[model samples]
Target: MKLHYEVDGEEFAAAGQASGNIKKMLKQLGIASDVIRKISIAVYEAEINMVIHADGGTVDVDIQTDKIYIALKDTGPGIPNIDLAMREGYSTASDEVRDLGFGAGMGLPNIQKNSDFLKITSAVGVGTTVEIEVNL
Candidate 1:
């Protein structure tokens, strides 16, 4: 099965909508609770990153018997340094974002921790794409 979601960058209230929906779908599909939890955490982190930094983005999910694949693409200001950005406490979120109780710099780390496979590609002036996979 495949699922797609469009995230609205300006809508903080809707930040987790995609992940939540996916979680529900996984539950209905009888996916194991631990697997669902991992996917949910990883997707939610990526979703929140898009909303907070990328202005907006698209999330595509592909579910198979062996694993689940997720791609998050955004046309926002790309990460300048992937290595730095992946650090547990490195974040470029604006003050306004931090004030909202989000953007503690743990998004990418959490995503990596939850995902079985992860890849991120980005351009300085263009955009970013994050690919994640979790074994079922």
Candidate 2:
């Protein structure tokens, strides 16, 4: 099955809607609870990043019999250093965003930890695309 979600950058309150929806769908589909939990957390963090950093983005999810694939694409100021961005506690979120308790820089690391395969591509002036997969 394939699912696609559009994430709005202006709505912090609704940032995790897509992830929540996916979680529910996964439950209805009889996916393992642990796997669903991990996917939700990872996707939630990515959604927040898109909202806070990028203006907005889209996520595509493909569910296979043995694995799940997720792709998050954003047309925002891309990461200049993937290595630094992967580190926990490293954030470029603005003060306003930080005041909301959103950006602690755990997004990428958590995504990496949860996924069996992860790939990130970013161009400083262009955008970023993150591809992650978790095997069942």
Candidate 3:
């Protein structure tokens, strides 16, 4: 199966809607609870990152019999340093974003931890694309 989501840049309150929908779909598909949890957390973090930093984005999810793949693409200001961004406590979020109780900087690290295969491509002025896969 394949799913697509559009991350909204204008609404923080709607940040996790796509992730929530993915969670429900996983449940209805009888995916393992642990797998569903990991997907949920990773998607939530990615969605929030799009809303908070990327301005907006697109997410494509592909579910296979032996793995699940998630690909996210954003046209926002891309990461200047992919290495730094992957660090658990590094963040570029402003005080406004932090005020929302986000920007703890755990997004990429958590996604890596939960995914069996992960790849990130970014350019300072261009954009970013993150692809992650979880083995079944």
Top lDDT model: 1
TM-score of each: 0.96, 0.95, 0.95
lDDT winner between candidates 1 and 2: 1
30-104 per-residue lDDT for model 1 (tens digits): 999999989999999899899888887999999888898999999988999999999998988889889988789
Error of 2 at 73 (Å): 0.4
Q: What C-alpha lDDT, on a 0 to 100 scale, does residue 37 get in candidate 3?
A: 82
Q: Which ranges in model 3 have alpha carbons more than 4 Å from their true place?
A: none
- Prediction 3 global C-alpha lDDT: 0.87
**Taking the tens digit of each residue's C-alpha lDDT, what string does model 3 give over 2-57?**
99998888987888988898789878889888988888888788888888888889
Pick out the ten consecutive residues of candidate 2 with the lowest summed lDDT. 18-27
- State the lDDT of candidate 2 residue by residue for 1-136, as single tens digits: 9999999888878888988887788888898888988888888888788888998899999988888888999999999999999999998988898899877788899998887899999999899998888876
lDDT of each: 0.92, 0.88, 0.87
Candidate 3 positional error at 103, Å: 0.6
Query: Model 1 — which ten-residue stretch has the worst lDDT?
Result: 94-103
RMSD of each: 0.9, 1.0, 1.0
